[model samples]
Target: MAINARHRLPILLAAALPIGLLLIFESKLTKGADQVAPPTSAPSPPIAPTPTFTPPSGPPTPRTPQFAPREYACSRAAVAPTLDGKLDDAAWASAPWTDDFLDIEGPARTAPRFKTRAKMLWDENNFYIAAELREPHVWATLKSHDEIVFHDNDFEVFIDPNSDTREYYEIEVNAIGTIFDLYLHRRYKEDGPAEHGWDAKGLRTAIHIDGTLNDPSDVDRAWTLEWAIPWSAFSPPVLTQPGFTEAARNAAAPQIGEEWRVNFSRVQWTTTLEGKTTTKPLTAPINDSYTQEPPKETSVTFPYQKVVGKPEDNWVWSPQWQIDMHDPRFWGRVKFVK
Candidate 1:
C-alpha cells in the first residue's frame, strides 16, 4: 500500500507541474495584450495642410476717356480757293473747283497745282484733315505700286517731318482711287521706313466729287477729303501703350486740347487719248487746266470762337489758310482726345 501511494504521489506531482506552467504562459500573454490594446482615442496621423491656389499676373488696360469731335460741314464757302492771295469772288469763278489750297514755303507757286495745296488740322482725340482736289478725269487702280500708277489719275499725299522729320507717310489714291498708304524715313526716299520702322494708324481718306470718274467729257467734280488719326498712334513708338500721354511723347503732352504738325498733297497726272491704251504723264500740256497754289494768305490759328451752327468752328487753326500750308512740317497741330 506504501509503494502504490508513493507512485500516485509522483503522478500527481507531474500533473501539478503542467498546470502551473500553463497558468504562467497564459498570464504573460494577457499582460502583452493589455499593453498593446488599440487606443480608445488614438491621435490620427497629422494631415498635411491643403495647398493654396493663386492666379497669375495679367496685362494692364487703361480707361478710355470721353471725347467729343467738333462736327463741321465741308460746304462750298469753307473750302473756297483764294486765287490772288485773297478770297476773291472772281477768282472763285475762274478756278475750276473752289477747294482748300496748299500754300507752303516751297517754290512750286508758279501755277501751283492742287497736288500740294491742301491743309491738315486736328483736335484733342482726333487728327482732323480735309482737302479739295480739282481734277478733270478721276480714275484709280486698286493694285499697289503698279508702274505709272500715278497715270491712273489719282490723288497723293506725302507727309514726312513727322513732328521732327524722322519718318514720313505717303498716301496715294485715284478719283475713284483706292487709298494706298506707305511710310518712309526722312533721310531715305525709298520704301525704307515701311520695311524697317515706320507705320500708320487709323488712316482714312475720302473724295467728294460733282462728276463721275472714268466717264470722260463729264465736268470734273470737286474732290473732298476727311480723316481722323487717333492720339493712340500719334507716336509711332508707343502704338500699343496704355495712354495718350505716352503717344504724345511729352511733346506738349497732348491732352484734351492739343495740336500737331500735319500736311496734305495731291497727285494729278495729264492723260491724253493716244489710241485705246491711255497715255498719261506727270506734266500737263500748256492748255491743260491749271492749278495754282493759294497765295501766302495767313497762318491758320486754332481755338477760333465757336459759333454754333456756323462755319466758323470748322476752322481748326485760323479761318484763312496759313502762308506755309505746303510745309507739312508746319501745317497744324491737334488737341488730344477730349
Candidate 2:
C-alpha cells in the first residue's frame, strides 16, 4: 500500500482540492442563511370593546290630534217658503236651527253679547236662509245697494258649493236690507280680489225689525232676515284653473246627499246717540288782532248715532280659530238631505 513520493503527492493534492471546494460551498450556504430576511405578517387589528345599552331618561311625549270641522244636516223644504222675514212658513218647520253663534276667534275669547241662530232649506230652484239675531239696539246706516253693508251691523253668508274653497260666493245684508254681494276666484289671503261687479241676479232678501230701528230710546227684541238665492245666481263668467273644466266654473243646483261648505257671520258695532246741544257764539274780542270778524260758532250734531268703538264685533256660526273668515277650510260641512 505504500506508494512513490511523487504519486502520493499528486493524489493528496486532488483530494485536498475536492475537500476545499466542499468547504467553500458550505461556508457560502452558512453566510446566505445569516443574510436572509425573516418571514413577516401584517399587524393584527385592535380589538373593540363591547357596547352597553342605556335606556332613555323619561317617558315619550304625546302628539296633538288633528282638528275636525263641524258638520250640519241641511234638510230640503217640501214647498218653497214665502220671501218674508218671518220664519212662520211651513217650509222652515222641518229645518233645524244651527248652534248659537260664537266669537270669531273661538271659545278661548269672550262669547257673543247677543244670541244668533240660522236655518237653511233648499228647494229645486233656490237655496233659502233664515236668521234670527237677538240684538237690543238694532241700527243701520248704509242704504245704497252693493255698498259696504258690513259698515253697518250685517249678516253674511259664505258658500263653497264644490268645497274647493275657490270660486266661492258671499252675500251680505244689513238691517235695512241693503245687500253687498260678491264672488271670489280664490281666498282674499291668496291675493284674490272681491268681484264687486258680480251681482246675485234674481236674489230676494227681506228684513223685519221687531224693535225700533236707529232709535236708542227703547230696548228692542230682535231682527230677522230671509233670503231666497237662486241656484243660477252662482254662475259667473268662465274661470280657468289648473285642473278645472268649463262646466266646473258654472254652478249647478246641488243634488241630494251632496255636501257643501258654508259659514255665517254677524258684524255688530257699539254705538251711542249724542243728545243735541245748542251753543251761543262769544262776542268778538275788543282788540282786533284778526283781519276779519271772528267766525261765528254754531252747534253741530250728527243726524244719526255715532259709532263709539273702532272695531266691530264678529260673531260667527262656527268659530274660525282666527279672525280671518275667508279661509273656507274652517267652514262647516253642510250635507243636503231629502
Candidate 3:
C-alpha cells in the first residue's frame, strides 16, 4: 500500500461511484476521507511461465471501464487437497493456475516484481483456493487471527456472492498461517470498516514457506498455501432476490459454470537489500492508491529495514484499473466446473 496505491492507505476509502450517483449520494452519505493515485511508465514484457505450469489460455482480456473481469474455470476437487500448505494433492495437479499477478493499477502500470498466481476448486462442503508466491525472502510478524495481518506481506481474498457488492467476505493470511477475516456490509465508501466479529467459521488455512523466516541471509524459493471456506457459513444473506432463500442457495451448491465475483491481492513491502540503496523508489506500482509523489523515494528502515508505512508492491489476480480493490465489479470472475 505504500507504493502504487489506488487511493491512500491509513484511512478508510470510499469507492468511486458513477457521477450521477455521486452527485445524489456524495454528500448525503458520510465519507471517510479523500484519496488519490499516479503516472505510468514503459510496460514490462509478457510474463514467462513456470516449468510446472502453462500460460493462461490466451492474452489477458483487455481491461476497460466496462471490460469483463478476468475469468477462470474452477474444477471440482475429486479429493480435496489436504489443508497442509504443501499442495501435494492430486486435485491441484489438474487445477489450472491463474496468470501471474499484475500491478493492481492495471496494464498501463508496471508489472509486479515477483511471480504470484492462484487456482480454485470446490466440493459440496467448501470452496477451495490455493496460491503460489515467488519470494526471495520469506517472512512474517503477525500471529493473532483477526488482527490486521496485511501489515506484513500477505495474500488476501475478497468474495461477493450474488454480486450485490455488499455483504461480502474477505480473509487475509500471512506466511505462517496467521489470519484476519471480516464481513463487509457494503464497500467502505458506502458502509464499512467491516467488523471482525463474524469469522470465516470452519475455515481451514495453512502455509509452507520455502525459505527461512526472518533470516534474509539466504536466497529463498517460494511459499504455497491452501485454504477452504465452508458453504454453510457463506449461506447467510443480509439481503437477496425474492424467493431465493438461504437454504435454496446452499442447496443449489456451486454447479459447473456458475459464477462468483472474486479477487486476490498480495501486499509486499520493500526491505533492505544488503548494501543496496536505502531510499527505495515508491513508484513501483503498489496497491490501494497509497502511492505518492512523482518518482518519490521512501526511506526503508528498521528490524526489517522496510519503511514502516510503505509497501514494496501491491500485486493482484486481476488488475483493478486504479489502485482500489474494493470495487468488486472489477474483480475476476470465477466459474465452477466438474
Candidate 4:
C-alpha cells in the first residue's frame, strides 16, 4: 500500500460551548481591525491574512504520535571487532541483542512471518550494527554498490544523529553485499528523496549467508550482516537547502550521554517460479499497510523479464505505526553508553 505523503492526521478541534460561556471558556475572540460597528455606513477595510510561523528546527509533526519512540542503550565495545559478517568475535560476547522486530505497523497488525533481531556496539571510530534475519529463501540480484539494493531482499539502517527530522542517512544491503546509501533532507512531507548524490565514504559492511543464495530448491536458515560506519563518513551535507543545524555540524561522534535516532528495517519478498527462465509474473499477498489498498499489479525487474514482486514483508526494530519510514518522529532512540 502506498501511503500518501501529504496525508496528516488532523488535529481535533475543541467544540464550541454555548455563547453564554464563550468568554468563560477563554478562547480568543477577535473583531475586525478597521470595521465600523455603527448603523451609519462607512467604507470597510480589506481583510488581513492570519500569519503563520514556522519553527527554525523543521516542520512540526503530529502533536499526537501514533506511538512513542523506543530507546536502546548501545554499549561500548571493549575490543573493536572485524568488519566480517561473522558475529563470532569475542567483542560480541557481552553485547546485548535488541528484541525481535515487529511489523512496521506496530504489533496490532499481522506479524512478520520470519524473525529479525539486531544488536549495536560502538567504538570511537565507528558506529557498529549487526543483524540476523531469518529467511527460508534467500535471493538477490543487485551487486553493484550504490544501486538500489532494496529491490531485492535487503536489510536497512536509518540514522538521524541530530534528531532534527532533517539531514539523516539510510543504508541498505542485500545478501550478495550490494549496497545503497543515501542522505535524506528532512522527510517526504517536506519533499525528501533518497539523495543518491550524497555518499557514505569509508563505510564498512559485510554479509554472511547461512545457506545458498538465489537457489529456490534449498532451504536457507538466515543471513547475518555487520556494518561499521565511520563517524567521518556521516558528515556529508544534505539537500532541502536548510543545510546542517548546530547538532548536525557537531555530530562527528556520540558522547557518552548523547542520544541519536536510529532504526533497522528488513525487506523480504516472495518469489514464484514460472519457468526455467521467464518468471514474468509475481503474486503478493494482500496486506493493507495503513489505509490505501495494495495494488494488484506491480513493476518488474530492470530487464522487464523477471517479475519482481513488491516487498511481501517489512520488519523493523521499532514499529513506526505506519508504513512510511521517512517519518523521524517514530524512530528509536540509541543512547551512547560508556
Best by TM-score: 3
Query: Residue 35: error of model 4 in Å?
Result: 78
- Candidate 4 lDDT, 32-82, residue by residue in tens: 588866887777998654232222233224764446677799999999976
lDDT of 1 at 227: 47
lDDT of 1 by residue, 1-338 (tens): 00001010000001111110101000010054556667689689996653322211221124311111111222222232322212223423322322343322222222333332343333344443444555544444333332222333444544433345444455555544344444433223211223223334554444455454444445454555444444444343433323222222432224433333343434433223212222212221211011222111221111111111111000112111222112233333332332
TM-score per model over all chains = 0.42, 0.69, 0.71, 0.70
Give the alpha-carbon lDDT of every model.
0.32, 0.64, 0.65, 0.64
Summing lDDT over every window of 10 consecutive residues in candidate 3, give the lowest-scoring window.
Answer: 21-30
| Candidate 2 lDDT by residue in tens digits, 10-76 | 0000111111010000001006455866589888799654232222222223431122456789888
lDDT of 1: 0.32
* lDDT of each residue in 49-78, candidate 3, tens digit only: 422212233323554333457889988889
lDDT of 2 at 146: 74
Q: Which portions of model 4 show Cα errors greater than 4 Å? A: 1-66, 238-248, 273-311
Clashes of 1: 28
Q: Between candidates 1 and 3, which one is better according to lDDT?
A: 3
